[model samples]
Target: MTYQRLAYDDAATPEQMHADCRVVTALLRPAPSIRFEDYPREVVKPTLEISEAAARLATALHLHLD
Candidate 1:
């Protein structure tokens, strides 16, 4: 599959995409700081929409590169 197609394909159901997005969001989140108070402020926060797009792009790149 082409990169664009792989990244934006409609083959994946909404549930699957949401799950993938959640995984990507978790992976992209910053590690907690040693100080509990600073942890929340320092951590990166990614929206679900952004996570979904990112997950799709990453998958596309990986498959294309292989």
Candidate 2:
């Protein structure tokens, strides 16, 4: 999975801050013999609409980055 965060103005609203946010997920069928990186992957946006909620949640929580 990958996240692309866009630069925003300091005064940007929550909606605007997440307007261009995108979450990319690379999916592959499970297989024992195949290497994870070698498998064919389908790239997609799994939660394109969840960014605003995520941002709000993050802002509310006190994350211990320990």
Candidate 3:
């Protein structure tokens, strides 16, 4: 028996790439100062769409680097 490999293509426009960067950055953000009062300004959180896009981008990166 032979194993089949998954193949995928990851390409995006400049705007889309920016959005994806935001998503991954948001996801990887360090825990803020552990305080209820001293909090950072609120910002729109990244969406599920961006998370998925970032995941796809990471997979593509790993595959390409291999």
Candidate 4:
């Protein structure tokens, strides 16, 4: 993330100030623009299938069973 210094003129209006504040907020911590359709497909499982399979095999062998 890059930090930018904002400058406002003395004649800045309420609307301009509000816009500048929004810009600053975005620069400091941008809001997520993800759509609903994309979020459901996100990977929720913490471990991959390969890791789970290896873990199961290790458990069956009683070698460092989790």
Candidate 5:
């Protein structure tokens, strides 16, 4: 038996890339010195989206995920 490698292309417009960057940065920023039991719910979608985008970009750039 032989195995064939799958291929994928990851490309994004400059505007989209910038937007993703901003989203990730905002999520990673230090939180305010306030009491909070949980993170904001609104940021969940953007945070996941940015994470996926970054993973794809890293793969496209031939970066090792490990």
Candidate 6:
């Protein structure tokens, strides 16, 4: 959960983006009691991936949870 910026290049292809999104979501979605800060620095890319997945999920579900 540490606030490290995602390091992947902005020009990453759609496939890479999708894979990253899945990895991040998987990393974040477990252990409901775990805070974001409990995650390690190496998890930043996955964190960004999770963020993107969350945004997409919200949009797809027509949710305004953000």
Question: Per-residue alpha-carbon lDDT of model 3 for 1-66, expressed as tens digits?
Answer: 998765966578999999999999989967768885786668788755446667788887884322
Give me the candidate number with maximum lDDT: 4
Off by over 4 Å in 3: 1-10, 31-66
Error of 1 at 66 (Å): 48
lDDT of model 3 at position 30: 77
Q: Which runs in model 5 stand beyond 4 Å of their true positions?
A: 1-6, 30-66
Candidate 6 segments exceeding 4 Å error: 1-10, 30-66
**Tens digits of per-residue lDDT for model 1 on 1-66?**
655535564678889999999999988967666986665556568644456667789887884322
Model 1 Cα displacement at 33 (Å)?
14
Where's the lowest-lDDT run of ten residues in candidate 1?
1-10
Global lDDT of each candidate: 0.71, 0.60, 0.75, 0.78, 0.76, 0.75
In candidate 5, which residue pairs clash? none
For model 4 the TM-score comes to 0.29
Q: List TM-scores for all candidates, in order.
A: 0.29, 0.19, 0.30, 0.29, 0.32, 0.30
- Per-residue lDDT over 13-54 for candidate 6, one digit per residue giving the tens place of the 0 to 100 score: 999999999999888855565766866556444333347778
lDDT of 2 by residue, 1-66 (tens): 998776974576877656645322234445576666876797886754556667677667954222
Ranking, TM-score, top scorer first: 5, 6, 3, 1, 4, 2
Residue 65 of model 6 has an lDDT of: 55
Who wins the TM-score comparison? Answer: 5
lDDT for residue 13 in candidate 2, whole number 0-100: 81
After superposition, which runs of candidate 2 have C-alpha atoms over 4 Å from their true positions? 1-9, 22-66
Q: Quote the RMSD, in angstroms, for model 4.
A: 11.7
lDDT of 5 by residue, 41-63 (tens): 45544333347778899999999
Candidate 4 C-alpha lDDT tens digits along 1-66: 998776964578999999999998888966686888757766676864458778888888887843
Candidate 2 vs candidate 6: which has greater TM-score? 6
Spell out the clash pairs found in candidate 3.
none
